[model samples]
Structures are given as structure tokens and as C-alpha cells.
Target: MITEKFRRQLRTEAKLWQTEGLIDDYLYQQLSERYQFDALEKTASSRFITILISLGGILLGLGIITFVSANWQQWSREVKALLLLTLFIGVNTSGFYFWRQQNTLSNTTNKKQKLGYGLLIFGALILGANIALMAQMFHIGGSPYGLYIVWGLGVLVMAYSLQLASLGVMAILLIGLGYLMGLSAVFYPGEFSWLQFIIEYMSLVAVLLFIPLAYWCNSRIIFFLATLIILLALEISLFRIFDFLNHGLWGAIALTLPPALLWGYDDIILPKVNSRIFQAFTRNLAIWYLSIGFFFLSFRAIWQDFILVNYSEISSEIHWLTLVEVLVFVGLTIWEWLCLARPNKRDAQSWRLDLVSGVILSFIVGTAILCFWHLSINEIPEIATFIINIEMFLLAAGLIRIGLARGIRGTFWGGLVLLTLQIVSRTFEYNTGLLLKSFVFILCGVGVIAAGLWYERHLSLEEVRK
Candidate 1:
């Protein structure tokens, strides 16, 4: 899809070309027709008006809510119930009517459509209020998260029916909030509620509920969040189970597995289903995971602490649920490797490993070896720390290299910052003299400036070549 900025730029360039006599009036008219130059102003004005209408609607809704709350205690149960039902039905009916009217009337401005969308969102909020007030009137008691879960599920149903991206996002947030709030009850002794069941299997539930919605809405944000929820849930489950085992094993799995899964998602999972829409998002997430995970692992203290932990007395029995989860992910990871090894049909050359993939694979292997050594010999080698530190540096350099090659400033700066942080951290972590620390800091500053200048030069050269 063409962005508004691009369209505006194109329009300006087309006008310049026409003025310079590079294109005839007929060609200019064709360009105008193709890009719909006349509609740009309309779109901008409609957007401004929509924002005003939405803000006004919000204020009006807030005023009505406050007024009702002020006199809510004076009303009887029957009156309260009737008012709640009427408000819910009336707001939703009006929103639907306006939404349909705008669609049916092509001559109408988008202001009505925007108003309809805002009202629908407001109706969703009112649904939650209605749920809360009705529960109070009926004297129903339960965990607060239970209420959020029900409210979120109701919103999710609306989202599915309407296929509205905003409502889908709202539902995800509500459900995620409920899950977070209910985590304490999951660990501590509490009264049983059906919501607890949902909380326990939230990872699977998020996948089942949000993944399809993401595809249905064609929303990258929803897909990213849903995947994040799944990864977090899996990590939490792993840590809980491995709290009894050697921390090294679970930590390695937690740090490596998610990124590996994300990096290979397109090849291993998506290809079978014939979809690549989310490939870029998954790879970006993988890079983020690796960068952060490697930074933490770069510290010597982390490895030393892992080595010092006493795991002999811990119970060997693993929870069945966590075990199954680990097994499934491990199985998928192995399958991904197999797929990567297979030759591509479109290309004669075998699948070549990219720098990022190589770095990730190396880190995983290094971590696995370190954990295994500690497990079998009951001692972590000093070389293990060195290996991890080297991996971190390599990852940083790799990111910078990839970024410069691709002309992505964020990736380049991300690597530069990571490299600088590692240097600064090491300088502070060790008992170095102040003079040496100051010298290192100065060197880092100079190095960063040099790298930035060189990157800019490289970008300029590439643009010239283009």
C-alpha cells in the first residue's frame, strides 16, 4: 500500500516534472488519475475532523458515566438493570446503524464512518461497565481477574464478529492484563475459579485466539504481541519447572529456544501452511531476543553464579505439562534444522547460513555445551565465559555488518550501542584503575564516531551506485 507521505512526494515530483516540460499535460493527468491526487486533501481533512469527533464523543461518554455514577445508588435494582441493558443495546445499535449508513452512502464523508468506529469502541467499554455493575447488583463475588477475563472474552467475541483491528487489540490487552493480575493466584493458594483454568493455559489460548484474529485482520502488531505472549508464557513455565533442576539448563533453553523458534518460524511452520506475511516480524523479534540475551550472558559473573549453584539436592521429577512443552519446542527446533539442511528446489546451491543465524546457532551450541559440562563434570570451565563473551562481540559486529549492508540505521545503531555498552560494562565490572577506565571510555567515544562516519560514507556510496 502507498503511504500518504509517499503520495505527497510523488505529487510534488510530478508537478515539478510537468513544469520542467519533462512530461506532457496528458501524462500529468494520467499520473493524477492513477494516484488520486485530488483525494489527498480530502483524506487529510476527514482525518482531522474524525479526531475532533472522537474526542468530543469521549468527553460526552465520560460525562454521562460520571452523572450516572453520582446517582447510581438512588436507583432500584430493576431500574439499574433496565438502564444498563438499554444503554448497551442503544449504543451498539446506533453505532451499527451509522457504520452501515456510511458504507452504503458513497457520497457521504468519512466523518460518519469514523464516528461509527468510535461509538463501537465506546460500546465495548460500556459492555465492561455493564458487566461490572450487573455483578455488583446481583452481589456476585469472584476474583478481579475473573471479571477482566469475562470482559475480555466478550470483547473478543465482538472483535471476531466485527473483524475490527482496534477491538482485537483491546481484547488482547484485556486478556493479557487479566493473565498478569491472576499470576499471583496461580502460584499461591487461592479459591478455585474457572478463570484460573484459562490463566494456566494462557499461552495456548493466546495462540488459538489471537493468531487467527491477526491473520483475519492482517495486523502485524497483533501477531507480534500474540507471539510475544506465547514466548513469555513458555519461558515462565520453563523457569517454574526448572526451578528444581539446574538453572543453567532452563536458562539456556529459555534464552535460546524462543529466538530459534522465531527465526525459523517462516521456514518450519509457515511454509507448510503457505504463508509468509509475518516472516519479517518473526526475524526482527528473533534479532531482538538474541541481542538482549547475548548481552546478559556476556557477563562473567552470570556464568560464575550458575556454576556455583548447588543442584544435587533438587528434585529430579519434572512437571508433565512443562515437560511436554519443552519436548514440543525442542522437536520443532530439530525439525527446523532439518528443513534448513535440505537443498532448495529453486536454487542449485544449498541453503546458506546467514551471519545472524550462524551467531544464534553458535550461541545455542555454546550454551548447551556449557550446561552439559556443568551437569556432567559438576564444574563450569573458565573457557565457557570466554566463549560467551566472544559470541557477544561477534553478534554485535554481525549486526553492524548486516545493518551497513542493508542500510538500516536502527540495526547499525543497535549494534554500535551494544558494542559500546559491552565495553563500558566490562570496564566497570572489573577492578580497573581510573586512568585505564578513562582511556577506554575515550577510545570507545572515538571508535563510535569513526564507525558512524564510515557508515554514512558507505550509505552515500551505495546511493551513488544506485
Candidate 2:
């Protein structure tokens, strides 16, 4: 993530220090060697080449389309079909030829490999176009979701056969689009009944298919996208199966699953997981979800909405999906706890991190119990606001504590930002006058600045001591 310019500046500083005898030449060499400065420049060059190749491919595709359009009037149906099939096969064959050469040819250079990659990318696009053109030529009916489903499956086959990460990503996107289209059709008024358009089931199928593909590909981008699709599918299933927009259910999910992932991802899941891509995805995804979800819950209006909306209409219907989600959550929670507790008492702190996860686990478990109790008694929503406020503050405080202990600036700033946002939001929500609001804003800004300075000074002192 570090930029080339920054790396260059760092190297220059190291040279200056060496020349001035502030640091030894050996130390300077170590500092210079610590960062892969060449990587940033190489990545930049690769991206530029990719962009240029993409543009050329686009222009070439357009040229072919123009020629085809000009000759369309004279071509018969059979001719058109034959032409489309020929182009599809030809593009893919050419791309594969180049890609194979790039990998196998001993004399092939980086430029040749990039060209191969570009051709493959262009071929993938052509494959999609070919599918749509064929579908149109045959007069295929029904929702566009059907077309997407077919196209996605086609790309998925290619992805699996070729073991291409880009193709895997494309397949996921296409399938997600199809799933969304299907969901829309199922809910479309007067056009289709729920049973008539069982599109949501495709989401489950997608999860089953893509999760394995992600692991197989060992691509973090693909894995992350798959995970998101799974989450979306699960949420949609919750909405459809429950037949109510019960905030309590969502709240329970938000509280338990994200925190479990955030706190136990590295300690529990990383040890068991083989794929570096999956581990990275889990850690980052958990961090973002927990931060954003907790911030959203800090607002009082959210709790008010949960209290105001009634779920009586679908209260009698048994939601099997809810049970599934709960079971999965519980399973993950138990697994995390077991992993955290497996070590001896002597290594407990190393595993548990000052009982931080223990506290988060306790809170999530308590929230889950309340969620189930509220399902029956529905009393928690009435007092949910106070509980959520307390949770938000505590979560923020915990993050700050962890950040300070670990010396992670990002986490520390994230905690400060969340705390500041909570305070600012509550301040403005009240019917305070302009003068009071101005004073409050000033107070917040000054307090934040002072705290930041103090933390920076503390870090500097620690560095000096080291």
C-alpha cells in the first residue's frame, strides 16, 4: 500500500542520516532493504499497461461490431449464428494460445505476459457478448435473470477450467446480478408470485458454488466478493422467510456475527484456515463490519424504529431461516470460545488479550439471549435504546484500549472517530440554540486535537525509549 514516492523519500532520508553519521551505513542499508520500493513502481507500470491494453481491446471490439452492423442486412440467420460462433471460438483460442505461451515460453518477457493477460480479459468480455447475442437471436423469453444465470454458469465453467482469478470474480458478479434480478421478479406486484419465481434459491446455490471456487482459486478479491454475496443472500433469506422487517433479528445478527468475526478471526479462524486470501478477507471484513455496524446502532432513531414497527402480522409463522442463522452464529461463537480457551492457563493472556474477547463474547451472548426472549415477550425493544447506547460507548472504549496497547494508529483513530461522531450526533439531535451548538462544536474540536497531540507525544517518547 505504500506509494513509490513515499518509499523514495524514505530512502533519501536514510541516505542523509548515513551521510551525517546519525545512522551507520549498515543501518541505512537495512532501512532501505526493509521496504520493497521496486514493487510500487512495478505495480504502477503494470496498471498503466493494463489500462492501455484495455482501451485498445475496447476499440478493436467496437470496430468489429461496426463491421458486423454494416453487413447485417445481407447476412442470413444461419450466417449470423455461424459468424457469432466463429468469433467466440476464435477469440478464446487466440487468448489461450497467448496465455499458454506467456506461461510456457522460456524467452517470453513481462510485456508478452501482459499482452496475454490483456487478450484473456478481452476474450472474457467477448464471451459475455456472445451469450447475450445468441440469447437475443433465439428469442429467449422470461426475465433477464435467466440470461444472467446462463452467462454466469458459462463463465464459471471457464473460471474453473482455466483457474483464472479474474474469471472467478466475473462469475460472481454475473451470478449476483442474476440473484438480484430474481429477487426483484419474485417481489414484483401482480406479475409473479413468490413460488412462481423462486429466484432467491439461486442465491443459496451461488453460495454453495462460489465459496468453494473462492477457496480453490486462492484469490482474496474473489473470496471477499463471495463472502459479501453470501451475506447478502442470508439477509435476503431472513427478510423473505421471516415475512417481517423485524429490527431485533437484524440487530441480533449485527451484534453477534460481526463481533465474533472481528474479535476471533485471527485467533480462531486463521489457525484453521489454509488460504491466506481467506484469512485476510476475514480479518479486514470483520473490522469494517464491526466499526460501521456499531456506529449505525449508536443512533437513537434506529432503536425508536425498532420499537415503533410491529411484527404481529408474521408472528405466528415459523421462520426456519432464523433458526438456521441462530444455529450458525452459536456454532461460530462456540468454536471461537473453544479456540480461545484451548491453551493452558499460563498462555491465557496471549490467547485472550486481557479478556477483551471475553467481554465482547459475553455481550454478544447476552444480546443473543435478549433477542430470543424478545421474540417471545417483545420487551427488549422498549428499552433497547439505552442498552445500545451503553454498548456503543463500551465498544468504542474497548477499541481505544486495544489500539493503545497494540500501537495501531488506525484502530486508535477509528475509536476516536466513532466516539466523536456519537457525541456530535447526540449534540445536534437536541433542540439546542445556535450559541450552545457552536460552543459544543468548539469543545469537541479542541478536545480531539489535544488528545491527538498527547497520543502523538506519547508515541514519540516510547520510540525514543526503544
Candidate 3:
């Protein structure tokens, strides 16, 4: 894990030692060879050159875009399509030439290589614009999601063909946006429904396309980005599909998805993926999701909104896609549980089991409170509010404990901050007297200051001991 900069520093020290006669010429030569000091020295200037080359490519792209905009009204339909295609092919061909031309040189960080990468980026942008503009020119009618989906697919093809991580990242973003737009469009119907197919299997399509690209590009960022988008699309799609908002099924989802991700991470995801970055990103995301979910559910008004409001009877229409999603989640959870039951895995502290237990408890509590409210229990809301607030507090405490066990400072602070926010927010939200509220606020401030001082003192003592 020796970085290039550290290698260079080591090389400098070796050279100084050789000059002072502390190390022999043979040792210095060996150090140079081992560290590739010669290569490092040349690359020191290559990054600046790369940026300059990339800027040139960007400027060239802007010029083309400007020319097209200015002459748009002057071009015929056929000519417009031809012009877009020409720009797409021409820029990509030039990029390929610059990239292949660098094969003649030994240095990998040459200006030509950078220029090629930049040109490829510019070409990818052009390809996206081409898809949208051409669709408009052809009088094709579809949702914005359809246009983006087409553009994203085009960019994805380029990324896979070139195996460029940067392009792959761009493709992932475009696809994610397309999925989001499609989800939004579902709520707000447009003039056309032709593009609904893209939204139907959005998560599945994104996973299938981008997961392979992530592997091909050898980029952990792309992999996790893809995973995040898939989860999001699944969440939204499932919410609508199940009609969860009407039945308060959001609580079930909020409680389950985080644990499911964690389970997938441990049993299936990590074994196949060789990226620490992806693992860390997923783990943090799970913590944040759970924390936010708990904090959101802590409010009494939320429960009232779900319970007090009269809901209309939703149609019994079957949604096959939603059924598939439900089955998939169930199947995966069962599969993970079976895997964990293996002899070797039995000893492991299972995040899935912990999460399942909590989810079951939350579900029971929520159902009980709802039932009580239905049965004319006036005190149901009060009981539910107290239990939920307690649940939030315990969840925060559990997060801090898990963070301590994992030695993650961010998670620990995140949990503590959540706890603080809940307390402060509730104090203001409730109809407490002014004097009582002021006293509670002052008490919380003192507690925080005292806790800070104690933590500082503990850190000082630990440093002294070290």
C-alpha cells in the first residue's frame, strides 16, 4: 500500500544516503529499481499536463455545441440526424486515435492518454445530447424518463466498450436519474405511457447493466453507486406497488431494507466483491437509514397521521412486479438465514437476526396500537408515542454500541447526534410550559457540556497512557 508520493520520498532518502556514502551505489540502484523512482519522477509532471489536455477537449466540445445551437433552425431533419451522428462518431474516433497513439510511448501518463480520456468524456456527453435531440427531431413522443433511459443506455454501452471508470460513473448517474424521473412520472402521468416499460423493471435493469460495468471498470465507487440506486428504485417501486402508504407499510420497509442490505453485504456481497470502499459505503448507509427511520417514527403526529386518517378502499388489482419484489426480498431473507445457520456461521453475531427481531417488535407494537385505536382506546396514542420514543432512544443507543464495537467514530457521533436532536426537538414540539421547557433546555446544555469535558479528559488520559 505504498503510495507513489511516499515511494518518491523513500527514493529521495535513498539517494541522499548514497550521496553521503552511508549506502553503497548498489543499494541506491536496488532502491531505485524497487520503487520505480524513474517512473515516479516523470509522472510528477504528467497530472498537470493531463488537466490541460482535458480542458482543451472540453473547450472543443463546447465549440461544437455552440455551433449546433446557432445553426439548429437552418438544418433539415435528415441533416440534423446526420450531424448528430457525425459528431458522435467523429469525437469517439478521435479519442480512440489519441488513446491508441499513446501505445507507441512507454509512459502510461502521457498527454496523449489524457487527451484520449478527455475526448471520450466529451463524446459520451455528445452521445447523450444526440439521443435527446434526435428524438425531438424525429417527433418521438415519450416521458422524460424514456429519453434519459435511452441516453443512459448509450453512455453505458460506451463505458463498457471503453472500460472507462469515469464514463461508467457518468452512466450510472444518468441511469439513476432516469429511474427517479420514471418513479416521479408514475405519480404524475404525462401525455404518453409508451416509456412505462423502462420504469417497470427499473431496479432489475439498473442492477444487471451497471453491476457488470462496475466489475469491468474495477471501480468500487461505481459498484456501490449502482447498489444504492437499485435499493432506492426498489424502495420507491415497492412502496407504490404494495400501496404501503395507505396501510402504514412504510414502517415495515423502513425496518427491513437496512437489515436486508446488511445481510446481503455479509453473506453475498462481500464474498464476491473485492472492494473495501463498497463495503464501508454500504455499512454507513445502513446506519444512516436506520437512524433516520427511527427518528422519523419517534414523532406522535406521524402515528396519528397513519392511524387517525380514514383511508379509502384500494382496488384488489394484482401487480405482478410488486409480487415479484416481495417474493425476492422474502427469498433472500430466508436464504441468508439458512446460510447463517451453517455450523461455521453459527458463532457469528448475526445482524440479520438482530434486525428481524427489532422489526418484528416494531410491527407488533404498531399493529397493537392501531388495533387499540380502532377499538376506541383513547389512551392508545399516548402509549404508542411513549413506546416509539423509547424505541428511538434504544435504537440510538444500539447504534453507539455497534459503532464502539466496530471502532467507527462517525457512527458513534451520528448516534449521539440523533439522540440529542430527538430530545431537543421533542422539547419544543410538546405543549410543555415555558418555564419547564426552559429548565429542560438548560439541563440538556449542562449535560452536553459535562459530557464533552469528560470525553476530553478521557482522551487526555488515554494519550498520556499511550
Full-model lDDT for every candidate: 0.78, 0.66, 0.67
lDDT of 3 by residue, 40-133 (tens): 7577778788688879968987998799889999989999888888888998999978876744223335556667788899898988788888
Q: What is the lDDT for 281 in model 2?
A: 54
List, residue by residue over 1-466, the lDDT tens digit for candidate 2.
4445667788778778888999997787677657654454666779887888889978998998899999987988789889978887887877777676642223324445556666777777777787787777787655677667777778888888888899999988887788777665544423543323335444456556786677667777787787777666555555544345455565455445655644565422543555344554565566666657656655566654653455445343434544565456446656766775667655545544337656766667666565545554565554655665676678778777877887778777878887888778777866888898889889989988997888888888888989
lDDT of 1 by residue, 1-466 (tens): 4566777999999999999999999999998887778988988878877788879978998999899889989989999999999999898888877776633223434546666787899899999999998999999987788888899999999889888888998988888888889886645535655687677667768877998888888888888778878887777666655565656566567656788878776623553346678887888888788778767767777767853565334333444765676668778777776676566888797666665566677777777777666555666546766777787788788889889879999889988998898889888988999999999999999999999999999999999999
Give me the displacement of residue 74 in model 2, in angstroms. Answer: 3.6
TM-score of 2: 0.73
How large is the C-alpha RMSD of every model relative to the true structure?
4.9, 7.3, 5.2
- The worst-scoring run of ten residues by lDDT in candidate 1 lies at 102-111
The segments of candidate 3 whose C-alpha lies over 4 angstroms from its true place after superposition are 1-24, 27-82, 96-108, 188-194, 215-220, 241-264, 267-280, 306-318, 345-379, 449-466
Cα lDDT for residue 394, candidate 1: 81
Q: What C-alpha lDDT, on a 0 to 100 scale, does residue 465 get in candidate 3?
A: 77
Candidate of highest lDDT: 1
Q: What is the TM-score (0 to 1) of candidate 3?
A: 0.75
